[model samples]
Every structure is written in structure tokens, then in C-alpha cells.
Target: MIESAFPIVEVPDMEAALRFYRDALGATVVYRFPPDGEPLFATLQAGSAQLGLGLAEGATAGEGAGMLLWFYVDDVDATTRALSDAGYLVLEEPSDSEWGERVALVSDPFGTRVRLGQPIAPQPDEE
Candidate 1:
């Protein structure tokens, strides 16, 4: 029924936010409007999801917590380590959960919480 979705973040400075997404999160610029002009809006691909960053009039950047967007990856540890190495703030270390998932959390420059997770192999059933 649902077609598709993407998360949009409002930023005061679109260029700086775009740089943060591209450098820290390892996102590739998929589609950017206005060519070489200052980016008022841009789309970036992080893993499978498309993240949008836009500049709005009189918008002040605020640090927000408790809101998290989760992304599924093949290797949680590797992704986390790479993000950390790229200067991203690692909020949580990679750890396995009882629910059969390995996950890590990080914070972006714009204060967006991102969760990276990978499913773990199921345990054998007891006889």
C-alpha cells in the first residue's frame, strides 16, 4: 500500500549540513538541485534510505534526542567503526541484544540520532 518514504531534516545552513552528511555519515549525493548553486535542498543516500536536508527561513538548529532513525546494514561493527573514524560521535558502542540484533548508535552534526543494526543468527532450538 505505502509507496516510499524519506526523512527530512531542517537545517540553518544547508551546505554545512550536507558536508556533515556526506563526510561523517558516508552518504553519497544522489540528487542535488540547482547544480553548483547553494543547496537549498539535497538528497543523499545512506545505505538504502534517502535522507533529505533543507534550509528553511529563520530556522535555528536545535539538538534533539529520543528520536532515532534505524538503518539495517550487513555489518554493524564495521559501519560503526567507520563512522567513528570519520569523526562522527559514537553515542553507543556496537553490542548484541537479546532480541537477536547487533546495533550501534551515533549522533550526527545536526543532532540526528542514527541507529545502525544487523540481525544476528538465530539460536538453535532446545530439544
Candidate 2:
């Protein structure tokens, strides 16, 4: 089951990107990584929609169209499994991410890669 979806845009410079989106489009910073100092990722709210910006290499001329469609699912592994069974190309197996989400990558029918992610559930307490 999918909960929500968003696009993660690749950017070369976080500060410059923030300035562009915030000044030109009036996008406000909603969330950012590394509580202090530099951030590797940031989420901005432009009107009613939220957009994610992540630092990526090879982004030139301040234009980045390398966007990844991210889906928040109920179960990352199960979702990837179903997609794989249905003949979709599973690019990466489901794995835990450092940011507290289980994630997987798969290529859509049109060859565009999409990411599936879900919050990691708390572990059961041992007796």
C-alpha cells in the first residue's frame, strides 16, 4: 500500500538552490537534514506541494531535471517483491537507509527509475 508520493530533485548546490526556489518561487524550507550547518537534503513547500532537494553530483549549469519519484509505501520489501513478480525491473533490492526508512529502487515501464520507501518500524523489545 502506498501512502504518499513526492519528487526528489537533484541539485548541485544546496544554498543556491534554496535561494532560487525561495526567492523566485516563494518556496519555504519545510525540513532539512543535519539539524545544523550544511544540509544534504531539504524539503521545500511551494504553494500546496512539497519538493525535496538533494545534493547530487554532475548537476551542471544550475539546471537539474534528474528527478526521482519517491513513494512512501506501507511495506518497502513487499512492494518491491510484487513489482518484481509483475516483471518490473528491480534495480536495487529493499534495504534500510541511514535516514530511518526502508527503501528500494525499481524501473518503471517507461524505463524511468522510481524509489519506494517506508518508515522503519520499531523493533520488538526482548524479554
Candidate 3:
């Protein structure tokens, strides 16, 4: 049985990756192994999700396909602002989607696309 799931991102440099996650995404360092050094594996907490960062031998950002991860927030505007202020690049500004969600797309320093979304206001009772 799968108890939980988390995304692991391969980065060129673990230290820089950790800094980006910590500073840009406001992720907190939960637990880190091999605590004695840099270029090691570390885990971070963003809301209820956990993201792992590891040193990729020779991998580059955006080397893979498909959506890496998505984070759901209560307020898209606030989240976007926070990420922007923290030095992340905002690929797409927050906008209400036709599917009924306020979403903003952001790219992390490591080139991972983070889809931040908040449920739209419930439509008033239909007549």
C-alpha cells in the first residue's frame, strides 16, 4: 500500500537547488541525510507535500517531460507574490480558468514548472 507520494527533482547542484526551494517556494527543511556536507540529498516541505532534491550526475533542468508537480494553495495571488518576491520566475500570471480555478504557473530555478491553483468561488445557486 502506498502511504504517500512525493516528487524528486534532479538538479545540477544540490546546494543551489536547496536554496531555490527554500527561498523561492518557501519550503522548509524537514529532514536531510548525510548532514555533514553539500551536494547531498535533502527533503523539503511545502504545505502538505514533500519535494526531494538530489545531485544529478549530468542532468540539466527541463530535461524531462510531463508535469513534474502541482501545488494547490488557498490564495493564488498571495502565493504568486511570495514566489516572485523570493526570486522565482513567474511564467504565467494568475488567471481564472474556464475549468473554474484561479491558477498561476511558475518556473523554479531548476526549471521545474509548478502549477499553483486555488478553487474558484462556487457559482451562485443556478435558477
RMSD per prediction, one decimal? 3.2, 13.5, 2.7
**TM-score for each of the candidates:** 0.75, 0.46, 0.79
Give candidate 3 regions above 4 Å deviation: 1-4, 123-127
Tens-place lDDT digits, model 1, residues 1-127 = 8788777877777877876778755789888776788878889998777988888775543246446768787899998998888787888999988777898988766667778889877632321
User: Which 10 residues in a row give candidate 3 its minimum summed lDDT?
Assistant: 118-127
State in Å the error of residue 75, model 1. 1.7
lDDT per residue for candidate 3 within 60-93, as digits (tens), equals 6652656556878889999899889978888899
- Sort all candidates by TM-score, best to worst: 3, 1, 2
In candidate 2, clashing pairs total 0
Candidate structures ordered by lDDT, highest first: 3, 1, 2
Q: Estimate candidate 3's RMSD in Å.
A: 2.7
Best-matching candidate per TM-score? 3
Q: Supply the global lDDT for candidate 3.
A: 0.79
